[model samples]
Target: MRAVVYDGPFKVSVKQVQQPKIQHPNDVIVKVTSTAICGSDLHMYEGRTAATPGIVFGHENMGVIQEVGAGVSKLKVGDRVVMPFNVGCGHCQNCEEQKSAFCTEVNPGFAGGAYGYVAMGPYMGGQAQFLRVPFADFNALKLPPGREHESDFVLLADIFPTGWHGVSLSGFQPGESIVVFGGGPVGLMAAYSAVLRGASEVYVVDRIKERLDKAKSIGAIPINFDDGDAVEQIIRRRKGKEVDRAVDAVGYQAVEKGGNTEKPNAVLESLVRVVRPTGGVGIPGLYVPSDPGAPDEAAKKGHLMFPFGKFFEKGLTMGTGQCNVKKYNRYLRDMIISGRAKPSFVVSHEIKLDEAPVAYEKFDKRVEGYTKVVIHPND
Candidate 1:
């Protein structure tokens, strides 16, 4: 089998590797059809994380069940399914409470586990011909058989639910306004979710013209930070009214306006400035405890100097963490089935498995029109 293997900083390759097998009685083997490269993967690709060489590089995945283990009863061979990026053990306390993202049993010392991610778990990613799915009964979401929603269904594995989770984290109410920082896939989904939930206003901030245009196509007001301070741009566009809520979709790798320098807390500070007093902020972006590529010593240790004083002064609330994907994927899946959502709109390219290395480089560079890249491993 061939899988996308992490080679080193700014490097990845689709190479032949050992195929995964059923290791537990409850495990199942999946023939992967579709997977995607997430922005979080860039952290490892850029040597910011402790990702070692040869680790399989995928988390968003969907496919058909090829084989089922002895204990797998609800699911069987030929079941079309999508597994959430989070790898939960199903029986852990967190899983019992529907917070599968933080399952204590899968990653041991870590609070959560994700397929093919650094420090998440030992689970190999699905960006390959096949994948080993543990706790199949609880982890895989059954989809209606067929290829009708292939593009949309695959998103249920990660970004779609994650974007919805970001809005939920903000305690958003219908008709409330929101400003989502970053216009990448997750950020666009956040804005789309806001629109579906009846937000009175939705603003998306980004420097890229392509991403901003996509945000506009989805009925969101696009704020180009490169033109000026994102907060000021949003406020001016809103006629001096701060938004009711804000979301940070651009985590630690955030860059300054009109420049390429990384400002780790740039989005955090902007969220504080743009959100109304007593309002809330949701952060669905990826932020690690340590960043080897950070620009400063404090940031290298995962500490940022955002305006905590302003946050406290304004009586703001914040919600931050990995999305508990199982908590929202089922409902979001149904949304796709009913045509209420089409997150595939953000997918700009669909390439074969062998094209993954090039996709990684282009996507990492934020090249125009490269908003999202989905890989079809078996195509």
Candidate 2:
């Protein structure tokens, strides 16, 4: 078996590894068919998060069940399934509350568990020839018949619903205005979700023309932050005022004029500057308070220099953290199946398992026209 192994900052290698086997009575062994690299995986590749070296580097995955343990009854050896990024024990209190991302019974030290992500649980990543899924009966979403193209649903593991979660947190009403910072996959999906939710206007701010073009293709107003102040651009369009809802999809280490800054404050700063005074803000971007390789002492505290006074003065509300995938995955799946949504629009690259090394390099560098990359382990 082969898997994408994390070597170091801006490094990943496709190497032969021992195939995973069923280790628990409740487990199922899946022969991974399709897996996708996520922005979160970039955090591990860059060594910004706490990803362990040698672990596989994928989480957005779908596959065919090759074997099942004695206790795994609902799923069989030939079932097709989509594995959510977060692994949860169905009996946990948080799982019962639909907060599967913070399952109390699995990986208790953290909010939840995920495959091949930093600061997540001990689960091995899914970007391999095979993977062992614990609590398989509860964790895998059985795909409907005739759904051969599971690549689109692969986004269900994280980014698809995560983008929707960002929009949901904003509490944006129909005919309202919204702005999303960052034009990466998540930001693009967030803009798409806003359009589905009846937002009259959606503005996406980013320096990249390629991503901005994608935003425009999805009917979002593209604001080139590189041309001028993004806030001023939005204000000028909104008649000298900010929009109703603002979202920050760019987390730590945001792009700056000369280079990237290790500051979570940049996203918040943009939100405060572009959101209407009484409106809300949605922050789905990643933020770690402590990092072993932080660039500065202030960054070590995970605190960004935010304008809290302005946030308070304007009475703006905020929602942040990892999205609980279980809460909306089933519904989002239905949307895809029913032709109401299409997540594959953001997939910019798809390659075989062996091509991960090249894909990682280009994606980590934000190479032109590379937004999301999907890997087929069996390709």
TM-score of each: 0.99, 0.96
Per-candidate local distance difference test: 0.92, 0.85
Q: List the lowest-lDDT window of 10 residues for candidate 2.
A: 255-264
Q: Candidate 2: deviation at residue 56, Å? A: 1.1
Give the top-scoring candidate (lDDT).
1
Per-residue lDDT for 319 in model 1? 95
Please give, for residues 1-379, the per-residue lDDT of candidate 2 as tens digits. 9999998788899888888888889999988888998888888898877666788877888888999999988999888888888888888888888888788777867778887776677778888988888899889998875445577788888898888988888877889999999889889989998998899899998888788999999999999876888888889988897899988888876766433554457668888888888899998887787866666678777856888899999999998877888788889899888989988989998899888898988988878678999998887
lDDT of 1 by residue, 49-150 (tens): 999999998999999999999999999899999999999988988899989999999998999998999898889999999999999999999999989989
Candidate 2, superposed: residue stretches over 4 Å from native: 258-262, 292-295
Provide the RMSD of all predictions against the true structure, rounded to 1 decimal. Answer: 0.8, 1.5
Clashes of each: 0, 1
